[model samples]
Each structure stands twice: as C-alpha cells, then as structure tokens.
Target: MPIKTPSELFIHDLSDTYSAEKQMTRSLPRLARAATDPQLAQAFEDHLEETRAQVERIEEIAEALGLKLKRIKCEGMAGLVEETLSMVDQVQEGPVLDAALIGSAQKAEHYEIASYTSLILMAMKLGYAPAVPLLQATLAEEQATDKRLGAMAEASAIEQAEATS
Candidate 1:
C-alpha cells in the first residue's frame, strides 16, 4: 500500500474515471446494436458522442493540473457492463429487451452520476475549481440520460410489459 496525498487520491480517481468513460465508448456500441428499440439504440449513440466530448474535458483538466493520468481499471463499471451483456443474451426478443436495457443502462448512468458528483466535490475542496466544472459537466449529462431513460421506461417499457401480460 502506498501513502497517498489528497492530490494523489484525486488524480487516481480521475484516472479510474477516465478509463471507465473510455470503456463506455466501446460498450455503448454493443448496447446500441443489442437494443430492440430504435429509440434506445439512438439514445446510446447520442450518449457515446457526448461521452467522447467528456473524455476530452477530463483530459483537459489533467493537462491543466500538471498531472498525468494513467488509466485504472474500474471493476464496478466492468461488472455493470458484463451484467448488461448477459442481459442481452437472456432477453433477445420483444419489448422486455428494451425495458431491461433501459434498466441496465440507467443503473450504469446512476453510477456515473455518483462518481462525477463525488469527483467534482473533491476537486472543489482540493482547490481545483477548473476541474470541478469538467466533472460537473459529465455529471449533468449522466443525470439527463438517467431522466431520459426513466421517461422511456415509463412511456414504453411499462406499457409494453403490461400488454404482454
């Protein structure tokens, strides 16, 4: 174990988050393809585009701070992704697939919201407001996606489930 300063901890978290976002860029495509709903697929595509901009923002924060971030494994996200992939295998047809996908994707987005919110607060307290906004920007996107997913789930998913039953 290494004794880490607050700055080091901040940097470590940033690196982990960076890797998580990068991982999503790849994962989102598969999710898009697996989606039974065209809307759901398009949502993933839009998110992937937003995610790329987020990566740039994070990198900008790293450069401004004179810190180099090394990609760290985010097991939580990896597990979430694996679960989603597994769900795809299990739910291959019908509206249930889209419902489940919205559920799984929202779970992932919630995790991201928590992570970025925490990171922003830490950056602010660490006297790094410039980085704070960068984290907040991502946080906002995650929240928006969550809201959008919730709407989709309510409008289409639940109705579909009821119809099938």
Candidate 2:
C-alpha cells in the first residue's frame, strides 16, 4: 500500500501490532516453559494473558474506526521470536538461559513500546480520539513488562548467570 494519508498509516500500524500480539500469544508460553527461574516463567505466563487482551483491544480499535483488521505480517516480531527461539535451543536450561530469555523478552517489549507510542501519537494527530486510550493502555503494559523483566534480571537472572559462568 502506498503511503497516502495518516489514516492509512494508522491502520497499517494497527494491523502490524495486532499481528505482533497474536504472534506473542503463541511464543510466550514457549518462553515461559523455557525459563528456569520461577518468577521469570510466571512473568511470561502473565504477559501472555496481557498479550491476548492487547490483541482484543486492537480489534476493538479497528471496529471503532470502521476498519477491518488487515492481514499484515509483522516481520520484525517474527525475526525477534526466531532469535529468541534460537537462543532457547542453544543455551542449556539454567540461569544463563533465563537471562537470555529476559533479554529477548525485553527486546520484544521495547519494540512494542515504540510501535504503540508511535501509533498513539499518530492516532492523536489524526483526531482518532477513541484509539488514543486503547493504544495508550497497551503501551503502558508493554513498558511495565519491560520494567518487570529488568527487575527480574537485576534481582536474580543476571547475577545467577554470571555466578554460574
């Protein structure tokens, strides 16, 4: 699709995020199972629920905007997930893998945060008032997830990984 209007761009971004969240729904459980740290595993599991909600919110936004969800593949997130999957296979089940998992999770969260932030700003600029709050909520959740991963890394994963090495 050629870049034409802000609305067009917004819809594209919306679809992209929707696809990303849907991808996470499948990937998160695997990540959770791969984690050796109890807290980290739980965090991934909790975020899977949040990811589902985010997917629904994006769909709601599409309905509110009178736009159908585009079937756009989020290649960026696919690449990220692939990288994480490779790490899971390469690393032994231990704190090192847990740390790598946190790093991978944080990278995905950061991508989401950036995407949602951009979408919220665009929605506001385009006067899509209804989308603003929905996107904002997801953005906040992504940020919180990132922070939780950071805390997990700082509190245990990183130190344990280093100690074992």
CA lDDT, candidate 1, residue 88 = 88
User: Poorest 10 consecutive residues of model 2 by lDDT?
Assistant: 1-10
Model 1's TM-score against the true structure: 0.95
Q: Provide the TM-score for each candidate, comma-separated.
A: 0.95, 0.98
Give the local distance difference test score of model 2: 0.94
**Candidate 1 lDDT tens digits, 24-142:** 99899998998877998999999999999988999999999888997578888899999998998998566888898899999999988888988988898899978987788789999
Candidate 2 TM-score, C-alpha based: 0.98
User: In model 2, which regions exceed 4 Å deviation?
Assistant: none
Best by lDDT: 2
Displacement of the residue 152 alpha carbon in candidate 1, Å: 0.3
- How far out, in Å, is residue 96 in model 2? 0.2
